[model samples]
Target: MKKTISREALKSASLEYNDVSGDFNWIKKRRGPIKVGQKAGSINHAGYVVIKIDQMKFMAHVLVWFLKTGEWPTLDIDHINGIKTDNRFQNLRHVTRSVNLQNQRKAHPNNHTGLIGVNKKGPKRFLALIQIDGIQKSVGTFENAIDAHNAYIEAKRKGHPGNTL
Candidate 1:
């Protein structure tokens, strides 16, 4: 189970907030004997920051939302820039999983076609596809990857609002 902190409890924790970095430094050590004003938590293997409060561990992004809003986020906290470690308050927003996925980076590690949604269909043919609401729709096949990608982008713009190529 995930641990959530209330705004009052967070205030009681005596953490100092860095306006520039949007990170909370522990001013008062709760259970651990650590120096005051030291940056709290460490980046986990998944790249998200984790802070330990008492015996419970919480994600720093979620904690930041609670601190700023005085309420827990009912939906996922998405990093607007798509960088996991950039926890600046301005870079964060509460969004649904689908909307969050729409704002993701264009290419993944396995992308070899150099364009998002464009893949090699054959030696000389490229296929463009887009997924909307968990359903994959084919844009069209093209002789060049760029053309296929263009079709994919057009389809994406029409299907998704506020989407950027």
Candidate 2:
């Protein structure tokens, strides 16, 4: 039977993947000789050898040890912040993709008035409106774009985290 990992074991495994002395643990070593269908293993600066087993990448030897001893975590490890490659356990968590996306700040530009709002009179002023439960509700309007944006933000904070006007 295939071995699964426990939560404690996963945590322990995660620690070895991090640097004991330094704040970061996932640093790219001299990039060389990585290919598909090959399990290349190496000793990280954190003082542990990381190897790929059965097409799975472990951050460190301890992570593989956890795989041998416990079940795999149900959720994918996510970086709470927007970083893509940082693998510190404290920065990592088991979360659904939607939850992770919700926790993230808007990265895309093109949001006029610095918030969700509608432009009027050739962009002279903006009126903010948000849709909640399929109903469009006017948040407010402002002479200045920034003020309109602030109003939109306030409305968002009041229980409309997903509101976009």
C-alpha lDDT values of all predictions: 0.81, 0.48
lDDT per residue for candidate 1 within 1-165, as digits (tens), equals 456766777778777767689787988756657678888888999788888775688888888888888878898898877777778888888988777777765667687897889989999999998998779999999999999988988898888764533
Over 4 Å off, model 1: 29-34, 106-115, 162-165
Clash count, predicted structure 1: 0
Query: In candidate 1, which residue pairs clash?
Result: none
Highest lDDT against the true fold, candidate: 1
In model 1, how large is the Cα lDDT of residue 47?
A: 88
Give the local distance difference test score of model 2: 0.48
lDDT of 2 by residue, 1-165 (tens): 434445564444323233332122323332455443333356566444455434454554335323333645454444555444443445456655544444434423665444444444245667876555557788876787667667756765564442222
